[model samples]
Target: MATIREIRRRIRSIQSTAKITRAMEMIAASKMRRAQERDIASRPYADLMRQVLAGLAAQRQGDDDIHPLLVQRPVNRIILIHITPDRGLCGGLNANVNRMAVSFVLEQSVPVTIVAVGRKGRDFMVRYGREVRAEFTHLGDRPSVVDILPIARVVTDDYSAGLADGVYLCYAEFVTTMTQRPVIWRLLPVEPATIEARLEVGYIYEPSAASVLAELLPRFVEMQLYHAILESIASEQSARMVAMRAATDNANELIEDLT
Candidate 1:
């Protein structure tokens, strides 16, 4: 057992930690609210974009009429865009994403490249000796779509240039304040099954159909990347808020027991 003076010092240290955790909890909560709202509000537009892309696929003809974005190819070289927090203190958020990403890489038969969207993801992959083709970090509490363009461009350009056969995104999906699930979403060679429900017929294009798709397909991809980043950030803040709240409570309990 510690002496009275030692116990008192320990209590003071815990109290200070509790104070910091509480502040972080409140800050994360505030940002989580905004991030969550933005994530939700953007869903409708995202859904519409998917619908349009599906409709374009429905318009597919012979090899000449198909858009390259919708063209399916064998998966040999793969790229995963992993999203995580720039900072720590969010319990298992980065760990969970990194685990899933590494699991994915391990399961693949060919070379896998990672496009890291935050410091944690980049650092983790680098430490494991995996290739990181592109990386973005220090995006702050909130980041706009413009900030995500380079990330989107890097992967899309690689896919277009045939440097990669498949593209994926790994991130945590915000289900609720206390629940976030890590998932892998394929971004390239768009899955027909996912958008089949939204497919429709009989739509005339203003310019040539191919011309219209050339303009819209890239934007569609960029939007999806932006949405993923937003979701990841929101989930990070939510997880951080919950973790901090728990830490504060645990500190309080410890202080009480010591007394």
Candidate 2:
């Protein structure tokens, strides 16, 4: 037993919080729609790019001169690009991605460094005593492919220069408004998806296959990274919207219970 005044005060505070969360839910819903559109729209192009890369990789199977990015060497040092949300109200989005990255790093025998793409991942990795090679944050709700080039350049330069042997990308993949999956995908050594020989169509490269590969490999890395970031954004917005909606509903339920 509580007095009438104390119960009234508690209800007021909860009502205020509910109002704020409702507003956030609306904002997140708006942003989620845009992010989902961008993420979905880019998937077809990414798939086609992978198919093209697979064909080019097949063409240079026996050649002595393979692109440096496509050369798979012994993994002595590994780089992980960990992407997460900067803010935390998105349920388990940050925790799920961070947990996946930590598990990956622990499982690797070689030295694993991180190129953190958001504040949450960077802070968690730094706190976990993992080596952070680079940090990128505040990329905003919508980012262009050009915005991701520097990140791609850093990893590509490191791999080409032998500073890193393998690169992995960790992010949340948006499936539906209620679902997001944490994924750790390989980014370096340029492993193109396997294609059947019968399905391959022979196309003439403008200059040479090697030359085309040289141009496309870096672009491929950039596109993959850009798409992953977009997926993470959409996932973050969806998770936040759902989380806030839950909070608002819980608050209302509590109010009714108290009354």
Give the per-residue lDDT digits (tens) of candidate 1, residues 1-259.
7899999999999999999999999999999988878777888887877787677655654546566677778887999999988999999988998999999999999999999989999999999999999889998777877888888889888888888999999998888899889999799966645774454556788876677777778888888888888888889999999999999999999999999
* CA displacement after TM-score superposition, residue 199 of candidate 1 (Å): 7.8
Candidate 1: the clashing residue pairs are none
RMSD of each: 2.0, 1.9
User: TM-score for each prediction?
Assistant: 0.92, 0.93
> Model 1: how far is 105 from its true place, Å?
0.3
Candidate 1 CA-lDDT value: 0.86
Q: Best candidate per TM-score, number?
A: 2
lDDT of 2 by residue, 1-259 (tens): 9999999999999999999999999999999888878867887777777777788888888789879898889999999999998899999999999999999999999999999999999999999899999999999999988888989999999999999999999999999999999999888988754432333667889888889889988988898899899989989999999999999999999999989
Q: Best candidate, lDDT-wise? A: 2
Off by over 4 Å in 1: 1-6, 63-65, 196-203
